[model samples]
Target: MSSSRAAVAGWALAACVYLLAQLHRTSLGVAGLLAEQRFGIDAGQLSLFVFLQIGVYAAMQIPTGVLVDRYGPRRVLVAAATIMGGAQLVFALVPLYPVALLARAALGFGDALTFVSVLRFAATHFSPRRYPVLVALTGMTGTVGNVAATLPLALLLRHVGWAPSFLGAGALSLVAGGAVALLLPDSTPPPRAVRTAAELRSGVLSIRGRVRRAWALPGTRLGFWTHFTSMSTGTALAVLWGTPYLVTAVGFSTAGAGAVLMVGVIAAAVVSPVLGWLIGERPSVRVPIGFGLSIVVVLGLVLLVTAFGDTPPAGPVVVFFVLAALGGPVSMAAFALARDYNHARSLGTASGVVNVGGFVATVLIALGIGWVLDLQGGTTARSLRWALLVAVAVQGFGVVRMIVWWLRVRATALHRQQRGEPVPVSVVRRRFDLRVTGPTGESGPGD
Candidate 1:
């Protein structure tokens, strides 16, 4: 198989595995009503349950980066997938609220490993020019997964019950784990045969040193902040909590809310790649700035309705979903910016930092929104409106972040060129010599 084909297959497998891993997190939104009735828990307690997952996942990201760097993605990912599956099984079988929360926390920690590992794999196997496209495509897979988690899971819950839905998700995760373990090739080589004992120690040290150096690069910081605060917060809130807010506050049914959330994701998945393509085709200030402006507009709409408008009105709900669709491309631009900034270094560090930032933002935002809900006397409509307002404000911060990044990129390019350094081209293609894998873990033939 060609390198391109192998990279494609490997990424497709990774995306599928990630989607399966994510089901536990997103499934809760649709299950909110059911869980409330069964457990007799109020909204605040239920929000805390989700918060437990986010907090665990956020805390685990930095270590996950180190694990990817030292242990290689193949081993780390297989372990994560297995743990994710086990947690889902526990979630399915457990009865008590505390036990379920424990299971959810376990699922959070397990699923935290997927994003960084997949990023490392993509950075190792694919060309630099192709990285953003692959990232966008992988992101789309996540949106698709969110859609499935909502509508399909809701439909499944309608007939089969939540326990069976979770059990089935666990089974799917196990199958995905096996496929990843078999199909994804390890990107690094084993220790050299002729090295002295001293040399062996130095080899391990050198690997750690490279990872450190990569983390310290200026580009890494620039990319990390851009994605973490602005891009990621929007995506997380929309996918994970969107349905619950819609149903609880807006009076939509479980299935109706699921369908609405699905539409939002489908719109985002469709729009993200187009923005990627536009950036690839033009590679200009206009594309990114316009992208940023578009998010501001969409988020502004969201903020307007949430802050000042009536929620039960059909006009506001219809407008909110349409605006929600516009957020996907903005996120795509942020991921692309990360790739563009990192240049020749380890994209894994950049990706990991961004992931860490985004999740941290999620924790802060989710908790803050919870507080706001309390302040609003705990009306579902008012609470949701407050959350939307918070999201819009956060997105405005993203717009500012992007503008700074653009200015920095421009200044750096000009400075380098004036100093007789090579002018960095918009599109760079770097070929790495790593054997790729398929869905079953067999190496691609002589790539």
Candidate 2:
């Protein structure tokens, strides 16, 4: 392949891994009640199926990043796909809940291995100028996976039965892994200072030390909080709650609920490139835009439930899903922040830390909502509405912290500029005011 074609092929295959990550991540949302029916589990246990996968995915981020550094993306990518496919096959045939849980856990492991490796891999393949748009598209590709897992997967389940559907899913995963192996262009690891990574792997540098060092940057934390507030609620909704709540609580037909989810994913796909361009054109807007998105989405959802109760009007509910899906693209700003502020060598760890924010939110809040549903004796209109309110509360809390960290990042940027440092200055919009912030901690490149 020509170099450009090779880059595209590699990126495309890597994106396939991410696509599966999102597919499995959101599979249970469509499949949740079915899984419950098959396993005879309650809401809380059903939540465990989704939440545990995410919890494991979140917990693996930093470690997976380290492994990508210590080993390489190829090994990690191949292993991840194999594990995911095999686990899904196991999940398809399993008759026991505990075994299913173990299968989901393995799936999470494979899912966790993907994006970091993909990001690190992309860093090696593409020029820095293309990075922002590429990151956004990565998220968009995952949303496409979400689309497939929705109505298509739902239809497959109806037509083919559970085991056959998932068997096909497993087979697809294995095929994707094989394609990646054959097509992704080989590249040398990007050069970077290895002392920190070397010691970190050898246990000379503690995991806490590396994590604390990365998190110590106010910009990194800003990215974390930005994603924490903006991303996960949409993810939580998409993962296990949106379809059920829409159908059972808001009087959406099953097809209507599936269409709503497909709408969200498609909307996210459309927005990702626009958001990526904004971030690339004006770095300052990264955090500010994320802040704005979180506030608007949280307020919109809050108003929807509070005003309409369980029987929200369809038109407004459609607006809510569009707004919520927009958050997925906005959250990509966190990666831009991590790329902007951290050194290239440290990018993997910082990215992993940044990556954890949303899924952590996804894990805790999804699990909490499941418990709340269980406590209320299932997905009643009242129970589902209350559960979503709980999600808003968490999102609201993240926005509060985002404000705190946003201010600190701005201050840190101003301080660096005053000290005769090289920072990419950009205009930040504040209430009735304009201010300055900084990024491109490196001269010509960013994450």
Candidate 3:
């Protein structure tokens, strides 16, 4: 097979691993009521489950990145799939609440490895020009997993009971793992000179310095904040609370809520390619597009919160959900941004730093909503409405931070360009219609 074909096949298999990760992460949302019934947990305890899962996932990002850098994506992906499968199997069978909590924590640790590995693998194999679209496509594939978590998983839980349903989900992971082990191409890292034992130890001790350096890059910080502002609302809603809110607050039946969430996933999938193309063709618009989508998200939340006390009309509710779904695509620009700012060697670490932003926001918002709902004493429409206000507030804070960072980074890049230092082509803003000669003196589009 051609190298490009091999890369595509390997990436597809890796994306399958990501699909399962998404399913595992979001599966709890669909199973929330079932989990509460089985474990006899209240709102606070249920939120604890989500909190631990997301918290562990967030905590593991940097380590997972370092491991990927050291061991390569093939090993990391295979191990991730195995661990997630085992965790899900334990979650399916465990009778005690504590055991179930441990199972989710294990799942989170494994889930953390999939996305960055897949992204790192893509960065290794693909050209820089194609990275944005590839990232978006990878995200779009994961949305399918999210959709499956909704209707299909819900139906399985209804008919086969929770244990059988989750057992089947676990089995899928093992199958994906086996495929990755057998078929995924292991890319060899570029050769490095052998170092003395003392040198290796010094390198290990200086890991913090490396991370600090990556974090200092304006583009890296911009990517982090971009992810932070773009994905928090969607992640919080889709992964933990969207279904419950729709069912309890919007007056939809369980199936009705599942259908709506599924629609939102579909909407995200549809728009992802467009967003990717826009970013790829005109990198200058990356921040603007994310900023615009965030504004729409804030507006949607405002409208939803305002209409919450009275039953919200279905049209407005559906539109709000669709806007929420757009977050995933917009946040994906962060990966491209990270790629532009860092070298391939530190791409994993930079990506990890960028990845942390959304989930951290997600953890806070999900927990905050649960706390608010608990404070109000029930999951009624009024309580859920007030709880959703937390999302609006969090999103507003993110937008402000994003604007501040965007201006800072843009100015830094413009100044650096004025000084004649080479910057990544993607970071250099240019007109859409500008034509420039390449190094070979062939005229074409310019950044």
Which candidate comes out best when scored by lDDT?
Answer: 3
lDDT of each: 0.64, 0.81, 0.83
Q: List the residue pairs that clash in candidate 1.
A: 182-440, 182-441, 183-440, 183-441
Give one digit per residue, the lDDT tens place, for model 1 in 36-155: 666777656666766788778877776677677667777778888888889999888877888888988888888888877877777778776666666667777777777778789999
State the local distance difference test value for candidate 3. Answer: 0.83
| Per-candidate clash tally | 4, 1, 0
Question: Relative to the unseen true structure, what is the C-alpha lDDT of residue 181 in candidate 3, on a scale of 0 to 100?
Answer: 89
Model 3 scores worst on lDDT over the 10 consecutive residues at: 438-447
TM-score of 1: 0.82
Q: What lDDT would candidate 2 get against the real structure?
A: 0.81
Q: Count backbone clashes in candidate 3.
A: 0
lDDT tens per residue, model 2, 1-447: 233876877888888888987887788878877888899998889889877799899999888877776566776788888889999999999999999999999999899999888887777677666788889889889888899888888888888889998888888888888887777665546545557766547664565677777888877888888888998788888888888888877787666787888888898999899888888887777877888888888888788778987778788888887788788889988888887777777677888899899999888788999899999998788888888877788899999998887766665555455556656764233463324455423231212
Q: In model 2, which range of ten residues has the least summed lDDT?
A: 438-447
Question: What RMSD value applies to candidate 2?
Answer: 3.8
Give the poorly placed runs of model 3, Cα more than 4 Å off: 1-3, 189-203, 308-310, 422-447
Better model by TM-score: candidate 1 vs candidate 3:
3
